[model samples]
Target: MFILADDMGFGDFGVFNGGQSSTPQLDDLSGISRLYSQHTSASPVCAPARAALLTGRYPQRTGVIDTLEARGTDRLALDEFTIADAFSRAGAVTGLVGKWHCGAIGEPYHPLKRGFDEFIGFRGGWQDYWDWTLERNRTPVQADGRYLTDVLGDEAVGFIRRHKHERFFLHVSFNAPHFPYQAPEELIGQHRRTGRTERVAVIYAMIAVMDRAIGRIRQAISDAGLDDDTLIVVTSDNGPELGGDGEESADRWNVGLRGAKQHVFEGGIRLPLVLSQPGVVAAGEDDTFIHLTDWYPSLLTHAGVTPVGSKVLDGRDISGSFTGGTVDDVPRCWQWSRYHPMPTSNAAIRDGRWKLVHPAAAGTLGLTDRDEWIDHDIKRHPENYAQPIDEESPGWPAVGTEPMLFDLAADPEEAHDLAAVHPDVRARLATALHAWYEDVELDRARLVST
Candidate 1:
């Protein structure tokens, strides 16, 4: 079982938030699960982050470098093999509930075609909470007055019950606290009474509802008599979205980490990861640096299933780390921008405690004209927009600036730059980071041409 939260910050968990938000179920789960202190999403944004999570490779290599689906940037290359493919091939029932942002345009990109036997969710970056249109194996189902989170939770419980006698993989992705913050009046009133602004109150209420739904899912698992046999993992796709302007503002505590959802800083990529199994994983904190990509190979290994193909995986099987084993420290890289990918903009590489970043240039993060209608038209009439596998690349202005270096061991906030103090380390990491950029872009280019 894998449970994912959308735009949930490090501090959103009550265990880390000092009681600002209500996440009692997650807080209790953390006590019995192995908490990773240095877990990070593979990307700072949703599409690419989920692409990396599903495939054991970087998002760039999978042809999902951005979030805009109308331009077809969010589609995962068909050649890539997902963890679900491995599990399904190994004879386990696989189901996905909630957000399926990896791809949203064509039937080829639907979750049903992507190794999932059952899928009940929206296939976009976001949806209206109160008025949602979900698909159960490509058949649309209109909303029925229940909150979206609760609906997804109920679907997850149903999947578990139906497959209780067989091996199954269930991914429950809750699009909570992401946007369009709508919650029950009771939850909103509780937070508002504590003096939170309308936006903050609504966002916290969304998270609170999600927390309760998660508790219900756990109870369902226990009732099915699969507690000892199941491995439950909870995490977020990326960090919180610190919203913009007036009532739209969603700024809140993020556990003193720097930056927000679209940034390359710790706060953008750093996320909470909890793994629980009765006797397999002991309850304790592990400071190992774990990336979202690791889950692909790790989960397959845990289930004793081999990968379906020989495609090279950028992630390693760290299942041993679940039981206090040491994992090798590997260099990880991240780069993201709107429309076409600009390798030098908002790129970072972390090798151990030292991280080198090329900050995003001013005026380089605006959405394209394609974004305006993509969200609305694509979901309703996807056949109208049969986007090419690789759309023509858009021109972007080059950004020129020296990279900044930070010793995260000392400055987790990333407030101070030590590039001048550590020129040699900066040069070495820069070479490696740029080399990674070239390699992944090369794969992306080949994917487009073929």
Candidate 2:
């Protein structure tokens, strides 16, 4: 089971030093799971990061560096080989629940066409948690009154129950704790009484609810006698969404990291990852710089299957790190740009403890707010908030003044810039990252043709 939480931060779970909300179940699971302290998302946004997670390739290669807008045509290319396709070829049943933001505009780009045997979720970036329309393999289903998070969990449990005897790849992607911070009123009140603001309380409540659902899913696995045989991976898509009256709550959720979602800071990409498989994966914590893209190769290797295609994957197989191995010296990269017709030019590089981020000059998409119908009344109700994946404005910052450098080993918060002290290191990383960006740009033809 590959469980993904939308917009959950490193400190959102008690296992990762979260104190704002109660995550008793996750905390307990962390004791038995391999907790990766330095795991990061491929991109800071949702769709691009998820694309990397599924493809084991960078989002730039997958044509998804930005989150998709509502009914947006931008999507994951059809030619890209997905992890699900790899596992299915190895004789495993695949099912995906919750958000499917990769692509939904056309039938060929749907999840079912992308190698998922079953899919129950929406394809947009964000949806109404309380009242929403979900699809079961392309058939729209109306499910009212039930919270979407619990419904997804129940569906995951059902999938597990039905496929207990077979090898199944269930992707439990929950859109919890994202925007539209909706939870049971009583649960929200529980945190509000603790002096947290409405937004903070709702966010905590949503996380608490999702954590309980995760506990249920884990128990179901054990109940079905698949605890030792089944491998479970849980992590967030990106860092927390720190916006709208969250000054006091930001510190609690961010856990001292610098930026939030949309920024290539430690707080945006540095997320917590927990892997549990009973006797297979030993229980412990490690600081492995595992990228979201690494899961494709790692999980495939864990399942003892080799990919069938001659695909160029940027991720490395780090399955050894799960069994008390170290990934101390592995280098990774990240970049982000809004949803546009063209690709992003900026990029970042992580070579061991050194980090470098250089933004690019802003490009024009020739879009105006009048072209899109922005949700204006979502904040009035506790169950709804603004969506974060809308198109970017023209004036948005495309590049930084100069390259920013930090020794993450010494400054995890990225408070100090060591570029002046270490010019050689900065130059080395810049040369490497720009080379990577050029390579990704070359791969854009695959996306454009699709």
Candidate 3:
């Protein structure tokens, strides 16, 4: 059962219904995609998403609900077990081949310390595709400086060749179509000839380059006859860059999704999760609701391994949902954290058509509140993290404000707020959101109780 997820924007592929470019590989794979609706990343941002995706626990419980905005002593706790640890315990080889921004420099939270048998690519999120200044397992790899995308693909293929005989998991994280967005000359030339002033061509070129490199990896797997045994899951860390106008042209980036990356809007949290497992998942789409945390259980189940213990997992194992099982009605939730307090309570609860967003009040920073704090702290207090520190509370302070509600099943764009009209739904979802969060706190206490 191999899943290949791409951080495909809302319109990156043609099969997206409102898709713009032609993503033959993804569109074809979607034949059995299971249309998992309401799937979301843990944080609206990247660092927190990876922290949650790797630990199978909500970022809030793991002290990483926000980005890795540490000065020194504020590092990711070393006691946590990541997905790689689970795979290792289950008797499988685990490796990471991309971005790992979960800790500060030289911290124990490095990928090698996080249970990966092998590590390649940068420890941070973005790196120059042309010049490889990124670190691999905390060592300088001396990037070719010609093009970055090609090198990342090459590394994955090489890793596959070396570990083909083992039941190994390869996490190929690509820093493509990401910032410092630089593609090759041939690709750039091809797009430039397209005659569109809208940098859509450049963005498309970036995706194209990534797709081609990915095809190489896919070919390597097939060549080694590992397609049947390998489970390839490829996806992005978050939504697209929404600034494709005069500023940079990605603002129109998500094609038409409601929000862009960075904030808790749909565009930022809603990413493409493409799973292509031969013989296991029938080629088609399923409209089930799931999220990043769910992948830990779903993949482990498919691999026929039991977890360390029931422990406390925020994600669910819906193996049946992937194997053509019908989906039951369940709601999804989101928490947005950055620097300052999230405008309003800084949470969202989605149940059926009703979706609630705890809006940042008129006087509050709103979307920028939390992010502002982190940014300011990093800038002003960079030296404040020079010494050892005491343990702190587990989660962000709960925001006490009215939530802005919308009917996603009714208004996916979130153009209208129904909070004033549907007080009952708002209250119900609000209660559920808070209770769920409290449960996360309780789990942390039990698992790491002193």
User: Judged by TM-score, which candidate is best?
Assistant: 1
Stretches off by above 4 angstroms in model 3 are 1-7, 17-24, 31-35, 68-75, 192-199, 244-247, 253-255, 340-345, 360-401, 438-450
Off by over 4 Å in 1: 193-195, 380-383, 386-394
Specify the highest-lDDT model's number: 1
Q: List model 2 lDDT by residue over 1-450, tens digit each.
A: 899999998878865554567898888888889988888999878888999999998887887755544424347877788998998888999999999888745567789988899999887766777887788987887767888888898889999999999999999999988877678999887777455567787888999889989988998998999999999998999988785655345335567897887767888888878899998898987887889988999899999988756888888888998789865457788877654422233457899889997544354322355433442222122123223344445565444447889998999999999889999999898888777777886787656665
- Residues 1-450, model 1: lDDT tens digits: 999999898888889978888889999999999999899999999999999999989999999988877777889999998888889999999999999988887778889888999999988888878888998998889989989998998999899989999999999988997876799999888887444568988988999999999999999899999999999999999999895787667888898898989888898999989999988898899999999999999999999999888889998888999999999889999998877678778889999999999887665566656566556666666667776435455567876356999999999999999999999999999999999999999999999899
Q: Provide the global lDDT of candidate 2 against the true structure.
A: 0.79
Span of ten consecutive residues with least summed lDDT in model 2: 376-385
Per-model CA lDDT versus the true structure: 0.88, 0.79, 0.65
For residue 24, what is the lDDT in candidate 3? 56
Alpha carbon deviation, residue 90, candidate 1 (Å): 0.4
Considering lDDT, where higher is better, how would the candidates rank from best to worst? 1, 2, 3
Clash totals for all candidate models = 0, 0, 39
